[model samples]
Target: METLYRKYRPKRFSEIVGQKHVKTLFINSIKNNNVSHAYIFAGPRGTGKTTIARILSKSLNCENRKDAEPCNVCNSCISIDKGNFMDVLEIDAASNRGIDEIRKIRETVGYHTAQGKYKVYIIDEAHMLTREAFNALLKTLEEPPSNVVFILATTNPEKIPQTIISRCQVIDFKNIPLKDIVDRLEFVCQKEKFNATKDALIEIAKRANGGLRDALTILEQVAKSSKNNIDINDVRNTLGLVSEELIDNLLKNIKEGNIINILKIIDEVYYSGRDFETFLFQTIEKILLLIEENNNTEFINLLKPLSDILKDIKYSEEKIILVKLGFLNLINFKENNNKTTNKVLENIKKESEKIEENIESEKTEVMEKDIPKFDEVLEDLKINGDLSLYIGLSFAKIQEGSDKIKLIFPYSKKLHFELIKDKKSFLEQYIKRKFGITKEIEVILSNSTEDETLKKLSFLFGKNYKIEGD
Candidate 1:
C-alpha cells in the first residue's frame, strides 16, 4: 500500500503547501511565457524541493496548463505523474553522480522533445554530483538549451559549485510553517475519516519541526498504531517524549524554589527512561519564551547555571547530578539576589537619612538645590520596572557636574559600567524628568587606584560624609 505522504503528495501548484514566494516566481514566469532554462531548488529535507520540481516539470510540458497549474487530466500530466513521460526525466543524483551520468544528460538535453513543448530534467539531490561531473555540466547550465529545462534540487546547495549556481535562478524552499503542516494533517484526517485530537495534530506538527512531509509520515505512523481515536497521550506514548504538563510543573516548582518537588520531577524523569537532555531542553525553551515574550524575569537567574549545566553535560556522563546541581543553583542565586537587593536598599535608606540630616544641620547649598538623593533615584527605578538596570546602576554613584550628570563606576565595577552604558538615553531621561530639562549623562569608569572613591564622592552628601558600598 502507498504511504500517506506519497498518496497525498501535491499534484498541482495549488496543492503545494507553503513557500508562497517560490510559487509566485513560477506562476508569474508561466503567465508571461518566460520560463528560465535552469533553476535551483534548495533547502532542508522534506521541504517540497523535489515535489515542486516535479510540479514545475509537469507545468512546463502540461498540454492544458492554466495560470501555471498543470491540468492533471491531460495525457502529458498523467505520463509525468506515472514517471513514463518521454520528455520529462527525474534523475536521482545521489546514485547517478558521475561523469557518465552527466554525459548522458548533456547528450539528452541537446535532442528535441518527443511529445512535449519542452524537455525537463529534474535532478534530485543535485549536490551529490561529483566535482568533475559538475564541471562537465557547467557549460550546459551556462548556455541553457532553448528547449530544455534543468531543475537542480538539493538539501545542501553549498556543495554545488558556484559556477553551476550562477547559471541558474536559485529558489530557496523553506520549512513549511507549523500551522500549514497542521492544517494539511487535519485535511488528511478529515479525508481518511480518521479521528485525532487537535492537540495530537499540533504535537505531531511540532515534532515534525516545519517539515510537511515528515509531519504526514508521523501522522500516518500514529494512525497505524492507534484505533483511529488518537489523542495527546497517544502521541507522547508513541514518540517517547517528555510530557508538556510535567515540564510545566517542573518549571513552576523551580520558580517557587520548591526544591523537593524539583527533585521528584527530576527523579521521575530519570527513572522512567526519558531523555534528560530532551527534558532539560524543553524546560529551558519554555523559560526562554517567558523571558522573551512576557518579559518575565522569574527564572532569569537560572540562565547562567543552566548554561553551565549544559556545557558540563558534554564533559561528564553524570547528567542527572549536573541537572540537580543546576536547579539548586537557581534557588541559591535567587536568594542571593534578594539578599543583595535588601542590603543595597538598606544602605540607600541609611545614606539618604544621613544626607538629609547633614543638609538640615549644615545647610549645604549643592545637594539640597541641585540633584535628587540617591534613594529617590533607586525608588524611581523600582517603580518604573527596570530591575536589571537598577541592579547594574546600584554599584555606581551619580555625580552632579556643571555641564553634565556623570554616572561614576569604580574601576572594579567596569563590567557594570559597560552593561549600564547601553541605557544612556534612559538615564538622561531620568535626569530630565527630575531636573525639568534634558541633561547629558556620561558613564565614567573611575581609576581603581584613585584612593578608594569614598573620598571623591563627598560632593553628594557633605565634606564630612564619605559613603561607599559594593
Candidate 2:
C-alpha cells in the first residue's frame, strides 16, 4: 500500500507546501518568461524540491498553463504525473552518477521536446553525480540548447562543485513549518477516512521535525497501530517516546533537591528503555527555562544544583578523567547509602538560606545608614551645585529603629514619585556605596507647609534660616 506522503505528494506548484518565497520567484519567472536555462533546488529532503521541479516542468510544457501553473487537464500534466512524459525527464542521479550518464544526457541535447516547446531534465540528488560526470555536464549547462532546460535538485548542495553552482540559478527550499505540516496531515486523515485528534496530528508533526515525509510515515504507522481514533497515548506508545508528564515530574524532583527521587525516576526511565541521553538533554532544556525566569532568583538558584548534578554524569570521554571522577563519586554514593548526598543537599539548603538572610541584612543596613545626617547629604548636593534640580529631588524620611526609609518631595507632583519608583534601585545602590550602608530605601511623595520645607532645608544645609508661613 502507498504511504500517505507518497500518495499525497504535491501534484502541482500550488500544492507544494512551504517555500512561499521560492514559489513566488518561480511564478514571477514563468509570468515574465524569464526562465533560466539551468536551475538548482537545494535544501533538506522532503521539503518539496523535486515536486516543485516537476510542477515547473509541467507548467512549461502544458498546452494551457495559467500564470505558470500546470493545467492538470492537459495531456502534458497527466503524462508528467505518470512519469511517462518524453519532454520531461526525471533522473535519479544517485543511480546514474557516472560520466557515461552525463554522456548519454549530452547525446540527447540534439533532440527537441517530442510534444512540447522545451525538454526539461530534472536530476534528483544531483550532488551524487561523480566529479567527472559534473565536469561532463558543466559545458552543456553553461550554454544549453535554447529548447532544453535543466533542473538539478539536491539535499546537500555543498557536495556539488562550485563551478556547477555558478552555472545555475539556485533556489533554496526550507523545512515546512509545524502548522503547515499539521494542516497537511489533517487533510490526509480526512481523505483517508481515518479518525485523528488535533493533538495527535500535532504530535506526529512535531515528531517529524519539519519533514513532511516523516510526518506522513508516522501517521501511517499510528493509523495501522490503532483501531479507532488516534490519541496522544497511542502516538507516544507507537513512537516509543517519553510523555511530557514524565519529563515534568523528573524536573520537579530535581528542582526540589530530592536527589534520591531524581535518581529513582532516572532508573525507572532507564529500565523502561527510555534513552538516558535524551533524558539528560531534556533536563538541560528545563533548567535553561528555569534560568530565564529572572524574577524568580530562588528558583534559578535551586535549579543550579540540579544542573550541576547533570553535568557530573559524564556522557562522553574526551574528558575521561572527569568522567572517572564522577563515576567514583557515584560508586561511593552507593556504598555510603546516600548519607553524603543528604549532607550535600543540606549544605545547599543552608547556603540558600544564608543568601536570603544576607540580602535582608544588607537591605536593613542600607535603610539605617543611607539617610545621611540631613546636613551632610544636603552639603554634598549643594557642592555638586544644583539647588533648582534638588528642589524637586525626593528625600526618603528615615524613622529611628525602622527598616523602611520613605521619600518626601513636595514641589514635584506624581512625576517625582514615578521617577523614584523607576530609579529606586539606582538610588539604593548610590546611597549604599555613598554611605557604606545596607538598608532598604522607600520613596514617598508628600506636600509639606512652606515653613516646614524651609526649616527642613535650613537644617539639611546646616545654615541658620527663618521661614515665613505661606
* Residues 321-380, model 1: lDDT tens digits: 988887788778887888899998887787677656644543342224335654566677
Worst 10 residues of 1 by lDDT: 361-370
**Residue 278 of model 1, lDDT score:** 68
TM-score of 2: 0.63
Runs in model 2 with CA error above 4 Å?
A: 275-470
Listed per model in order, the count of residue pairs whose N, CA or C atoms clash below 3 Å is 0, 12
Candidate 1 — what's its lDDT? 0.82
lDDT of each: 0.82, 0.74
Q: Candidate 1: give the clashing pairs.
A: none
